[model samples]
Target: MFAIERLNKIKELLLAQKRVDVYELSEKFSVTEVTIRRDLDKLEQKGFLVKTYGGAVLNDKLNSLPNASSGDTEQKFVEEKRMIGKIAAQMIEDGEAVFLSAGSTCLEIARNIKGKKITVLTNDLAIGLELKDAPGVKTIVIGGDLIPLSTMLVGGFALQMLKGIYVNKAFLGVKGAQLDSGYTVSHYEEAMILQEVARISSEIIIVADYSKFNVKGFARLGDLTMAKKVITNTQLPNEYKKYYFEQAVKLFTTFDFR
Candidate 1:
């Protein structure tokens, strides 16, 4: 992997997990301890962390801010997400309403949406704000309890808002994905809401990076069967690629689009 990509992932891990060990990062990226230290040093110089005895801790200044958490999520796989977002945005036709689920990748989709006259329903505060000023886009945020650590809105209030309407397409993001587990997230309440949305939508499109592949989370919403298409990075393994194909799922890679 490129240095910038690895750096972004390390930053992401530190922000999410609070700390990062030199050895663990080395092993995770298949690099040497010396290389990991250099990476940490670079982060340190940029005020992202404080180097400890054997690892680095996320900056104290960043820990208490919700914005920091969301920013870090966007740091990883940025190019891939941007490409996926661009391609996903292109898939939407004029006057077709769509649902934009909450996540870093889904936020990218919101960012890349073009000048189409369409209504947008989303449970993400970030997505709502992103499209607030866009021309020819009408955005609606679902009513729900806000998750403390991020901007996601979920639960019964969100579900009730979707009762009478169906969207042409729903773009979703997943915390983990496996053939067995399908698409999952850490929160059960959010899972319930997303599952309902998936059921009501005519077509489901998942936007995720390779890091989510084979990972399992606490709660699942929809499976590969429910997802009509998946937009992801080229870093995904051929094994998973073949697996999606066997399931009759259309997989669009960022590298292919570029």
Candidate 2:
């Protein structure tokens, strides 16, 4: 495997298992013990993991991505995500068809969607569970391989289902947002599904918090040109504002709670 691919697998293992042994990782990735040690050192420097005598442990820092099962990061930025969700909810009109992407922010947007005579398509199991029984709102859950960490379905089945239908608007979530990279996710499969969703939506709205700005992830979703508008918190840097304007991407900010 390539160096980047190996690094990503190491990250996935660390995130999923919370700890990884150097010898075990060497055998799993088919690399030498020295190479595994080097990988651990690099990951530790990136703040993704902490080195131990025989292995590495996942980091608990707020700036680092939390372990998949921890769910702490989602709860940490709850209010900021809710504010972004409220603004995104306003964009939906009654009786319109909408697609909601998976993420903490988009999950809040699904909850904030009020009395709307609309059909909602989503791969997020959480969003489906929240809006499934709501009166007058039609909810369709896309079926495919389940990503346990994100609790979303993405793969051949989901992509095929999306091909048969289109939406008036789509609300997306990102692991990072850069002027050059557009939006990104931590995994390749998720990025592929997101790109397909963006292609079939009439208007693509990205719901991300200010912390996402300038962050880099493992995979690229698309560039800024793909989004019609980006809804985020007011703390977004002025440099990003200038870049988005130049790229013809409209910027929408929610009220500052801080």
Query: Highest lDDT: which candidate?
Result: 1
lDDT, each prediction:
0.84, 0.79
- Runs in model 1 lying further than 4 Å from the true structure: 1-11, 14-76
For each candidate in turn, the TM-score is: 0.75, 0.72
The numbered model that scores best in TM-score is 1
lDDT of 1 by residue, 1-258 (tens): 999999988988776557777866775688899999999999999988999988888888987776685463455556677788898999999899899998777888888784788999999998999999998999999989997546889988898998999999999888778888788886798898888888889999988888888766667776767786998888887888988889898988887676
lDDT of 1: 0.84
Expressed as tens digits, the lDDT of each residue in 91-167 for candidate 2 is: 89998999998767888888888477899999889899999777878999999998643477989988889886789
